[model samples]
Target: MSTLRTLFLSPRVTATGHALADAARRRGARVETLREWRVPEQQRRAEGSSLYAGPLFADAVARELGLGLLEAPQDWLARLPRELTLRDVEFGTIAEAWRLRRPAFVKPPNDKSFPARVYPDGSGLPGPDAVDGTEPVLVSDIVTFAVEFRLFLLNGEVRTASRYATRGALDVAPLERDPRRAEVLAFAERLAGTGLPSAVVVDVGLVDDAGWAVVEANAAWASGHYACDADAALDVVLHAARPEGEFGAADRRFLRPAPEVVRD
Candidate 1:
């Protein structure tokens, strides 16, 4: 039986959220769409509760309810072998990225703190006045993928997957229909021991002439389902966000840092 008794959703429920909510209902779990940052008084004491939302909002709710949300380490991608990433990637601060003399793909590792795109050069990045100089970001060589897939992983195995794009455009399709499905799964299995949270999203793509390479890793709580099976994706979400008391020893290392609450 699933331990999830109630699932909290963002106030503005997205198509993905709706799908997960529906799946939760089938599992006999209550769903609540929060209208604000505050947790409802009644749910404050609810047990077996979890959340699915964006990073900032999810962080706030997790802190309020003492839930442990798991995510990849901020430097996970940058630390991966170049053989896996298929490009040179570095973990550095926004200020450091500003010193780049050549075009590079830059993005925040765990949050949407800044736009993730290929900047012409250092001058094209956001100014220090706009973003903190010390904020962590990933800078990598530019690579184009001909096809991209999202895999929902749980317990070091891919529970579900979907082809989310082709040639940088939206093109959702079931992984079962793809001819290269086995290759994709094989690549994901190779990443199983890479220290990611048990439940997380891994995107892999076929670089134009580079074969398959990892695009990035995302928190299951914040990733889109695309064409994935909602039930399987929900399993990942439940594992990703659980009561702090339910976390195993290994899970502790992957917990996302609690966001500091701002008092009015």
Candidate 2:
């Protein structure tokens, strides 16, 4: 049974967000686009509500509604074995990354706190004046991906996937048309039930010279569907953001910390 009765969206809507909202409506669920950060009084009294928005907006609304948003641990990618990652990756502070003398790919683990890109050297990174040196970041050896696909995983299986990029450019296409479809599915199967939240997004790609490698994990509630089946993506989003009381023991460990709520 679906646990979603109402789907709340952030003030800013994207194409993917509209698709999800339409899908939710087709499934007999009411959808509402939030006018502001504050949850409306009617929604506050509604039952079985779930949210799909950016990390910051999702966190605030989820806190107000007592919902739990599931996401991979900040260092989940960094902890994966070399066989899966296919390159060296480390989780450390910006201050630590600033000491890198060689080129590397650096990004924040869960949010867009900083621009995620390759830096020629430490000097290319944001200085202490623009960002706090203590912020966490993922530093990885630079590599090129020929193509990248986004997999929306639910219950340890890939429910839907879409080719989201080609050679670092936005190129959305159905996964079924790709000749590498079988290979991508097979590689993703290896990561089934591998400690990620039951519903999450995982990006995998074919490196220029390497085989398949994981790009990163993202919270399903905040992920873009691209060409993925909107209905299937909606299913993942429902599971990714649900009432806190319904969380299972396994899912609890992957829950994102609740945001602090201030009341007048």
Candidate 3:
């Protein structure tokens, strides 16, 4: 294979892309730095398009250069190929806001963690939490972020997994495997051919009490790299960029022998 040329699509002083690029380069790959690329202001005005012009540019470049695309997590990532944002909430009058359920939240849909209090609690505290209650902000039902899982993807395939800690940092090994991790992996398998971008990290969170719900999917744009096996992730990158061979859609059978329950 020709020397793999990678162009890092991010701003300067970024630790995420820098680390990955360094790893890829030391492994005999030629990497490029494309810090100039970012989502333009005008592209936001496009009508009814799910694709963001900025990341889409990287997606194209990755295709051309045979490089992989990694991105940070964000609202847009949850709505891939649709340019849909998890923002844009249904705001209501003061009366309606008062009528919100006990655990229901009154936060800007744009905010990731809800409550915005000194902590996510009833005591709306010192800062942004006290913003105008009547402003056209977002409100949503609050779900407990019990332990979270971050499944790294190279191209569209999943690499090894880890947990997303409270400080937004990646955690290596934690006690007790996620109860619903098995189901989450199954969900990822369903998207095996959905044309998701290469070099991406998928964050699948569980809904409170719901079995293995997709909290949100993210592009690798602003994602963190913790315990991500560079070699394994890179392999996914190389495989996705190559010409796809003709394969049967239903060729692989899952039901041949599924996993059995662990009887204690």
Q: Give the candidates in order of TM-score, highest first.
A: 1, 2, 3
Backbone clash pairs for candidate 1 read: none
Clashes of 3: 13
The sequence of per-residue lDDT tens digits that candidate 2 reaches over residues 1-264 is 245799989999699899999999998988989888888766773678888999888767887776889999999899998988899999999999899999999999998877899989888888999987998899999889999999999987899999999999999997988899999999998896567989899999999877999999999999999999999999999999988878899899999998686767
The lDDT values for all models are: 0.89, 0.89, 0.42
Model 3 residue 228 distance off true place after TM-score fit, in angstroms? 1.9
TM-score of each: 0.97, 0.95, 0.46
TM-score for model 3? 0.46
Cα lDDT of model 1 by residue, 38-141, tens digit: 78677784788988999888877787776889899999998898889999999999899999999999999998877899999988888978987999999999
